[model samples]
Target chain A: MSTYRVVPAGSVFDRFAKHIFILPGLGVLVALVIYPTYYLIRLALSNFDLTFMTKPVFIGLGNFIQILSDTYFWGALGNTLVMASIAVALEFVFGLGMALLLNEDLRGGRIIKSLLIVPMMIPPVVVGLNFKLIFDQFGPLNDLLQRLGVSCVDWLGNPLMAKVSVILADVWQWSSFMFIIFLAGLQAIPQYLYDSAKVDGASGWRTFRFITWPMLVPSATVALTFRVMDALKIFDVVYMVTSGGPSFSTEVLSLYIYRTGFRFGTLGYASAVAVIMLILLTAIIEVIIKETRLGKRLEWE
Target chain B: MKVKSKYVKHCLHYMLICSALVFYLFPIYWLIITSLKFPGDVTASPVVWFTTKLTLDNYRLLFGHTGALWGAKQYVGRSFLPSIAPYITNSIMIGVLSSGFGLLLGALLAYGIVRFRIGGSRLYNWLLSLRMIPPVVVAIPMFTVFRTLGLIDTWWAVASAHLLMSIPFSTLLLIGFFSDIPGDIMEAALLDGCTNLGAFSRVVLPLAAPGLVAVFIIAFLTSWNELLIANVLTTTAKAQTFPVYTTSFAQVERGTAWGPAAAGGVIGMVPMLISSFYIQRYLVRGLTMGAVKE
Candidate 1:
């Protein structure tokens, strides 16, 4: 048997060894992230518009107040919330279904699973552009629609349809992510439970509900957490496809922030928006962690 | 009857799998076909599914290649607004270097935390949290910081931004790998006249190589796919990454040249697709372990 022990408390040199090993990584993080985060908060409180000012003027909560009053900000927030929730919900359901299907003793299951992940691995920008081409007015999708005897619809031009287009593209790319996570969870379920359930004459649905679903909750929670974060911060796809156009209808929070900071040269206001997003995400994640007990599951050594 | 129903279920399962395969493969197939289509064929209404006339004009234009082998398409060289070679090279550099540095820093951090208990579990959580922080938030401040350091439009700046996400992820993942290494082996090595560094280099490193490679691949993919930081931080051709370069093809002002844009998309996607297939097994472990084991 092998004994496991922490490096024993020892001389100054030993203690220094640990610190020395850790410093390079932690130092880079502090200089890059911690320091900038502090500066971000400061910028949020100031008037740092590059268009008019050479230096940021401390304006306290001026930028936040401006953001609160701006209907565009509210619209972007609403769009982000809608996009994230809808996309994540759809991804979960479809991914769960796919995972269950793939778990069946079907020939070529491995290949199918591997092929499914291709969409998620492709660059998000390409995903947006790929969907853009597909959703073009004279593109294949609309052509298919016309052939199906349905009137051609403006996939990326109409506001409601544009939002749907973005969401569908997102779901297409990310459902595989959810599938992979769910498949792992499904595989990890002990077979004896299913065997006993079968012996008791339970239906497939019943077996899944009673045995599989509960066991897969941890992975589901994990998947949901990742999808929610990614969806909330969606930028590349929206920016590529629509650029938040059709009268600012599809402008997501991140896209809005990017435009404000980089396009409009309003760094201070953008920083405020960014800060608010961070806080909002943190609060939402905290609630999720509490509800799912996900934090408790971390075996962070 | 039950057996018949089970056969039906299997058929349905296979049907679903085929649908998924089509759904995933269609866009990629379309990108290839569209890239090969001539400019006029690309824009034809009722969307040309199969092009009667194929041309390498788009690829030639995008690459600024005037090779005689391409014949007439070679004559259309330098017509494309910008060549994609610089962007591709920049992305490759950023991906390779960031993943490289990220693995080094992450391994060191993971080893310290796992072996010596550097900052407890809280530090681990903090690192994971950094990955979740919206890149836009960091980009706002870091933009100015990079501007000050004269690092804007530089590969190092882009790589540094990518390191933000990759280092934390690589560390979290490597911590998992390092923790699995039997402590007794390290102790045995220590007793056999090996220093801590010597044990890591001689034993732990060799054992952890596979995991390290997996971490590097994941880091590379993450950096490769990243767009927001690269877009914000790099203002010039020198550091404009592939994703950013691809987006230029679809810029709203330009009316989207579909054939060439599709070519760019295919160019950007091929490496990722190939590499993702190679690392498919490790993908689940990397994603789930990082998420669940935290």
Candidate 2:
């Protein structure tokens, strides 16, 4: 029998060597995450009976209930869901459309394809700043709308328009991502698909329904799941554009947590909000990825 | 009959393409027109207003100068060229260093995990779960940690913070890339008397070059455009990135300057556009990994 055994007799020595490479990253994760996360939970759950900073009275789940019932929290959640659903849904449709379009045999198509991706490259803050300026009453959008004799609606002031503005801005930036993925998916679809569909005399819409939709579902699922997850956590534009203002009409869950924790010095309450949001975002993302064929299928046309 | 059907499909396809173009192109046109006009015309004229003086003032202010918006003048200097120079340098340095170092680390960690099977497959998957938490959730906790580490207000601090997100991304990308390489080649290399590391560096790395470039560009963009944790971690101009520098254009007292901010926005698009021009093939290949593996 070989003297060099699997466990190597010295178990600790073997284990340590086995994972020598994993250490540096794991160590950093500990420093950056584990300790602070511990402190965050501690700060949230422990009651400072003596002083805000002082020693311990344990009040379990008090903060959780407080936040759960809080009107502001509910309002933020509602706003967040609306934006996420609208944004994700629209991006899916637009992305699918672009993907299909780019699939066509067009001339100099590559140049336009490249131009389409430029919006996604700009920084989010610059995006927010640019859109904010553009949405202003005197901004070009209003200027053009007025020239056409249409009413110049307040793009960022009204609650519905604010949500629409933020969602539209996001769609502009990320539709390209959706486009890119769908293009890849469409190409992967064996060309025999069309040849056979043609043999059967299926109409364009019918071929798409039978071939494209079924095959493209996985990519569509991915694009939808990704955008939905990301949209839940929107903060930047809502912050710079409206500051979730005109009396909190635009506030989302992430923005609310920021205001409560950093702005209001309610660290304990804010931590509770953060924990809830973390759980919610992960759970929703998991459900979407699982329920849809996104994670399970490689049928992929 | 088939040819006639194809003709109709082409017509429908062109219509769909036009609508998509209209949706994508309109906002960019709006952005350009707004940036060109003077501040006075911005509010006074209804949509599609023209600038009496179509000035490059916004671009000039972003490059350097003040009162155009983001007020680089008071801090960087009065000069138009050097005022925004520090922010430009910092953005470039931080973006390049973090991306370069991240690719190196991602390669090593990916190799260790994939080849050695150092931990369970579940553990590898769990490592990727870290990114799903979203940056906003982790921002405060990281801010506290970076503060404690005395990493606040340095390029290293921002870069390290970026690693929290990028490492997972690059590592997962690598896993997919590695999985695409034929196992038989690796085994053959081993039989040919090459050590594990030797085969990895020689065979696996080259095969995955397209993937590496794609992941590197993606990683570079992630760090370059990140602003949330960046806003808190870096206090001064020396540490601030491009996004933060552009924020200085939001001056309320003088009313926000569109020109400089828009100019800065346009400048920020350079790295991404220029990158796409050359490495376009590598990018799509990188993004569509495992999706098309033979």
Candidate 3:
């Protein structure tokens, strides 16, 4: 019985040995994360401009008050929500369709599946640059449209089209990510469930709705949460393609913070915006976790 | 009747798959072809779908060996333009070091969590939340701190920032891999008179090699492709990455030099393209933060 015990109980060295494995990693992570976060909070509460050589001037809640009155901040916040929702919704639909199609176990499926991963694997900056070329005035897309007797529309120049183009680029790159996740979910489903469903003579749609859909909830939650989180921080694509576009119609919150802090030299106000963004993200994700009961599923045994 | 119906369904599935592939592959195809085209052919009307006149002038221009005088002259006064070689070197150096360090730490942390149950679910949740924090939020303060330490524009500044981003993600990923390894193996090693560190290195690390590879690739790629933190931390070619250099084309005032930019984009995408093929099996597991294991 004593030999069967895995947790050592003999010596002081044995008692403290476990901490050795974790302390180095966790210590580095904590040290790296804690200081910036602390400084970020401190900067958020002060007036620290990069352009000025003077020390920060502490101002209580002033930046937050200014944020409340700033229409640009509100517009950027609105754009972030709208873009994330629309792009994620489209990605979910297209990804699910792709997953279902690929799940059929057709001939040459492996090749097609590997090819599908290409867009998602490439850098977001490259995706943006690729789309920028394709959306150019005389590029392939416009030529194709013109050949089809449709007019060539300005893609990045017009504000509405710029938003549409950004969403399109995002969907093009990320739909494959959702597809991969859903496909994994689909594969994880036991074949016996379908076998039993077939014995009962259930229709395909009914089997999917009752069996597949319910089984797929966990994967859907993960894909949606990650995609939404990533879409909210959509600076690279927008930075390359539109740079917040023709009259700032596509300036999402992350890009807004970048412009404020780096471009315009207003570190304190940008830090305030960033703090707000962090809180909003945490709150939204918490609601999502609670609503989906993902927290329950994420627990360790 | 059932056989015919199955045939029709197969046809429908093939059609859908083909169309989706076309939608996904066309832009990539365009990017590659544009890189091979001359400036005139790139913007040519009718889209120049097939040009026998494909040129590597863009590549030559990017490598700074353009024998074409005009291409050389176009970039003569552009001091801000980055030479592609040094930036690529910087990216590789930073990516390898940061992700390497991230893997070492993450593996140990994951091992501790799986075996000792040190932090449990609460700690796991905190790590997950750390992964969710926006890069911009971290970028501002990291910039300030690095500057104060006089570490700005060095590889260390960018690599350390990237390490912060990679650690949580790598730990989360490695946790799934470590959990899959049965505890009996560790117990067996311990019963053989091995210390915890010895058992971890000799027995566990070998078993987790595939997972470690996958995590390293993903972490390296994340650092390689990252722009916001890297952009904030490094200003000169001394430590800037390929993505930062690629973005400079977008900022070129006279209008983007699409040919050279496309060439650079193609170069930047090659490693990931090759890596995707190698890691296809592990990608779903890695990308979802190990939530959905295949």
Candidate 4:
């Protein structure tokens, strides 16, 4: 066998090589990210509407003050929180149930997993449009309801139902995401732990609570964090289905921002709303990461 | 009694799994059937679950073959309903270019961090935070910058914005992959007179090929499926991606063209549906940004 040789630590290549690999990519990203953040803050503190024939006039705390009293802003924020909490909660429950069921010794499990992936893989626009059809007045869902001797519900026309419809569409697409993550978490637990639990005469519930739940916390935190972040940014589905309709009952933050900036041409005010959203999301995520110790669990150390 | 209970439980398990499958798949099925139905039959009161009178008129309209359709008179002046071909091309070009560039930069960055411990844990936290920034926040300011630069309605504009998404994601994923590569292999390559860059390109890259492909496909899908950034940056079919094109069907004054929209949705979803199957093994890692290793 040939003896192994070691490269010298003080080689010519070693001194400057890391910088070459790291700087270009990092520099491009930081520059791109930083400029927009700077511009966003500047835009937030000004009056920049496309309708007016004037440059952006800097007005300190003006947009923020306006937001404080704007009913629409509060309504949109409320709607966003409501939709995200309900949708993510439902997704988590259904996803956990499905993951538990799937972890059993069932035949054709592989095929089922592949099929489960189809929903989350489809584009959100497509999912939104498809759900819109299903929830339409004369669509399949209403027809099925009528056959069962129930009056057809105006799914998108009513404020509450429109919110429910939007949430349903989101749950349908994203429950699979939680399912996939939780399933991975479940599988990662060693089989011997379950066997030992069984030897101690522990029931299924106890086995899960004592052994599985604690082991799955890291995965749950990751999955929940990702889903919560996504749920907060809900736009395509709401835009396609309701356009935040029925008197803005389902107007999420992202849709609100889009309409304000693009439709109403209030770039400055929209930027202010967007800045608030960013800070709120960052704060929520920081709490999650800290409380769950997800940063450490993620091997970031 | 015990054996009977076990059998009952197994049956219950099968039933649950079957129903779950139906729940997940029914919407996709509904999309396809609706796309194939005649315009009148599409909204029939009883809901035409299946029809032998299936027609490709929706597809024809979406493809801009309206000149030959029987009711061509109705679509005469509707200039907004253009062929989806150009938008599809735009999406393909943008997805490929953005993800391709993202993979290059992200892979290099990931290698440096994993191998040399370039930035440490603080950098990792920063990258994760970047991933969490909502798209609307970025889109707002980028719109003004792009408009000023006259880059609005160009593929590069959308592609560059998508790079904001793809780079952090791909880097995070590649960091996981690069960490998995054995250090001894790289050392051996260096001992054999391979330069640092040479070892990465020739040895580390080949070993991590699967992970790279996985990252590229995911990044491609992210850019491809993205709507907000693409919508803000593109005003017309010149650089509009497929999702933007699909959303054009929703005209407020005149009711939405459901049939054609369904067809557009189908066409937009086909590539991803196919890719979903191809990348099944990597789905967990890719979706979770390597938080969950398969």
Candidate 5:
């Protein structure tokens, strides 16, 4: 940082070099993020005639209005929220438990830790497609249940189970991510904390509640916030597995937008949906980010 | 008494580990099993049980007979071909190109940010915020933009879109890496014949090799596994990736061809799974970077 360059003022090459990357970087940001967002909003507010692409009509809030009155939109929103809420909560509890287990000095812990991250590494579409096969009427899930002398229930066939099935797949892949974060946090806490607590006559439960839970919240917050944001935008799994389902039961917001834009060619409606999703997600993420290290802890990591 | 307490602790840890192993590994195990089974036998073994026969056809088909991907039959378009093979190649190509490009761009920007103290730090943090924003939010908008630009269904389109996540993640990691290289050392480089860029390219970069390598692998893996945008943006094999290759198995008439799809799924993930576990240390370091101070 203290390095001084004494190039004369007339050295245009160095001057260009100094500021060269700035404009290119800005250009990249706009092209990659800002422009696409702009065009999407434009399309959402515009008119699309089939024969000829119509001049974009300025229908103020009309698309949002249609979205508001549409029952499918509401259903999609509800399903998306339910999926995120359930998946995130499950991942938190499940991931916390998994982290605790992996932290143990067990013979198979390494193998288990390696195995745990396998699901997340799989492509999301494949995860959805794989689950699609698993959830079939005579799919392995049912066959397995039948083997246990229990009657098989319709998985994707039923409205509720479809959502539950996708949630389960998400929890399967991502709980490990949460676990990794918590494990890191746990590793950061000195072993002596537990030893000290024991010396102070703190019961195991008391030590866990006071030491583990409180100390781990910052890490938990990072993991949970990430999972929650991702779960809301859950598309690949839903789109690949159900394509919004037997009765549109599994159509989260992203799926709805995907269908609206690509399948039906309703660019404006899809754009509006996309924008709403972005705005809503941004608001939620901003709040969640507050609890994360970036906003709260204020460190590079 | 101390020995007894240690024994109880060990027992508790064992109990927790066993239950977690079973629960966490079940679904993935089921996927692998299903991939190895034929359609009829997919459910023949209990939902979570092992089947008597294990076949390798699913894995075989994706590796496909033809190397360059030729058309078996004429379809709607002038030159529609069997996508399964080409799709794999396309995915690999896109993954390599995008991640390669992303790494270069991310590293250079991260270097400038870290070394020169070029821009406001908040802007750098905001980039991390973008990293956190789910791709779904950007996917739809970008889909429209790409479509308009005639870049839809192209490799570059997908690659550029990936920058949205890769840049910020790379910067965040690189910032920590660069900062860890004490200011005194960078100043020493300037005292030599090294310009900021030269010093960065020659000295700082080599020093940050571990971080760069970790970032490269992660970026590559993410691009390889990406599905949502790829599925929407690309309709044909020309730009489609392996992740979406299985979706084509779902013909409107057929409910879903589980055998081929699961087989494809397995093929696609195997490379990633193998490398990740082998490089698990780097992956963990990459993920948990910025976490601990040097």
Candidate 6:
């Protein structure tokens, strides 16, 4: 039983000692993240196309000019925004509905919740493949349609339907995610509020409108912020299912950047595309965080 | 009449849940059924709902057992890329390596921020914002940087890229969890003459072990499910992960091979499905990054 000795609290060494703890993480973060991001911004400003050179030549926003002029850039950006909004909207509706239903006191509720979340947990590529199988011209989706006395639709081949298919697959894969978040939000509402509402003779819809909806706002905003950011970065499912195909109809920003960078080896131009995405991503996040009042809430917390 | 109406409402509620369940479950069910079906039955028109005759040919092909399936047995030896076993191994290795690095550095950073109150909420917010930085933004520059360093196509390079992902996530999560940890315990440890590092390792670490496990799972799964970095980074099976390998089957020149690809899809998804059941609560908490707690 050796007696323990305490280190001095306000010693000069303590100040420097904190930096030791900070350095390991800070070093890696700087090396792997900060430097790379810095390099990316620099590369974005250069004629850094790997196909043409061993070293990136500084061109001072030539790549940005190129990106602005490129028709595909605008197309891809429009597609990304559309896909994100459509998928997120559908997911919210379906997810909120399911969350409400699941919130009820029901038999095997936990099991059902777990099963529902399976889609969200599976790999995106696998989700893409499963949807591809389902939407095959001769597949079960068409089979179900035919059985309903409807003509079979070419779900992935037709341009409009292909976009719909991509969104459908995204919704299928993530609505459960929204469901879980909404369920958590719903559950987090104190039972006493409902009890007080009941004592006030508040009707079901009115209670929901006055009490539940407001209570859910925080979680809803959090969920939507996460969903929108994730949806905007849609790449895996698109790459897996359509490869941004039927003539680039589903070519979202990430997929187009990936094609431009990797396949064509135009790293400079691709970096420019990525920098724009990064800016947009930052702006979207900033807006959402502010609009949701989440930043303030977080600060107070 | 009142009781009957209430019963009918309950029935409708159950029906709605059941329909949602089917819509969610059918694709998974289809993948499994398709994986079990023979190659010929996979693309069979008027879609075979169920099959009486199932074959393991897809799984066999996945395991490089193509001696009899293809007439030229020699082609079997060269069938390296499509082999499912290595891809699974690669995925597991990358997942483990990335998570290991991620959790180590993340836990350390989180402890520093929490105990030292370094930068306070601002630091935490800055770290969380790092997560919003799209991987595509850094991918190309990172690619060129790694290429210069001669780390391109290496497992370490891929793991390092994924490490960037997991750090912010785990750090943010642990910060939330650490805030919940009673501060008096750390003060007690400090007064007991344990150094700050000692307090973290012996005191806070044991308390936060479950959270670390949860973060590891999240980090591992995120890395496991990623395709773009793996696709761009690794050119060969040596470092390419399961998602990247499985993706090749979807875009094969000969046309998509439905049966084997379905088998791979089933195989790829199984581990996640199994792990998800155990992590459901942790997952929700992690998914929100402790932004909205349960």
Per-model TM-score versus the true fold = 0.95, 0.86, 0.95, 0.96, 0.89, 0.94
Q: What is the lDDT of candidate 3?
A: 0.87
lDDT of prediction 5: 0.71
Clashing pairs in 3: none
Interface alpha-carbon RMSD, every candidate: 2.6, 4.7, 1.7, 1.8, 3.2, 2.2
Q: Looking at model 6 chain A, which ten-residue stretch has the lowest summed lDDT?
A: A1-10
User: Which DockQ values do the candidates obtain, in the order shown?
Assistant: 0.60, 0.36, 0.66, 0.70, 0.44, 0.65
How many clashes show up in model 6?
0
Runs of candidate 5 with Cα error greater than 4 angstroms are A1-17, A21-23, A49-55, A291-293, A296-301, B1-12, B38-40, B43-48, B66-83, B132-136, B250-256, B282-294
* Top-DockQ structure, candidate number: 4
Tens digits of lDDT, candidate 5, B1-294? 999999998888787777777876665677778778755665454343676677775555455533221222321221222437788788778877776776776777777666556656466557756765556567766776676789988888888888776766676677777777887777777676566666778888898888787787787788888877777778776888877776666543232345556667777777687678555665544554354321
List the candidate 1 regions with Cα displacement exceeding 4 Å: A1-15, B51-55, B67-78, B252-256, B292-294
The regions of model 6 sitting more than 4 angstroms off are: A1-16, A296-301, B66-81, B253-256
lDDT tens readout by residue for model 1, A61-167:
99988887899999999999998899999999989988998886777777777888888888999988888888888888999999999999998889999999999
Give candidate 3 misplaced runs (Cα > 4 Å).
A1-15, A298-300, B1-7, B69-81, B253-256
- The residue ranges of model 4 lying beyond 4 angstroms of the native Cα positions read A1-14, A298-300, B70-80, B252-256
Candidate 6 C-alpha error for residue B204, in Å = 0.7
Error of 1 at B240 (Å): 1.0
Better of 1 and 6 by DockQ: 6
What would the per-residue lDDT of candidate 4 be over residues B172-286, giving only the tens digit for each residue? 8998888888878877888887767888999999999988988898899989899999999999889999999878665433225777788999998887877786688888888
Query: Lowest summed lDDT over 10 consecutive residues: which window, candidate 3 chain A?
Result: A1-10
Task: For model 4, state the Cα shift of residue B128 in Å.
Answer: 0.8
Q: For residues A196-229, what per-residue lDDT tens digits would candidate 4 score against the true structure?
A: 9989999989998999999988788889988998
- Score residue B77 of candidate 4 by CA lDDT: 29
* Decoy 1 TM-score against native: 0.95
TM-score of 6: 0.94
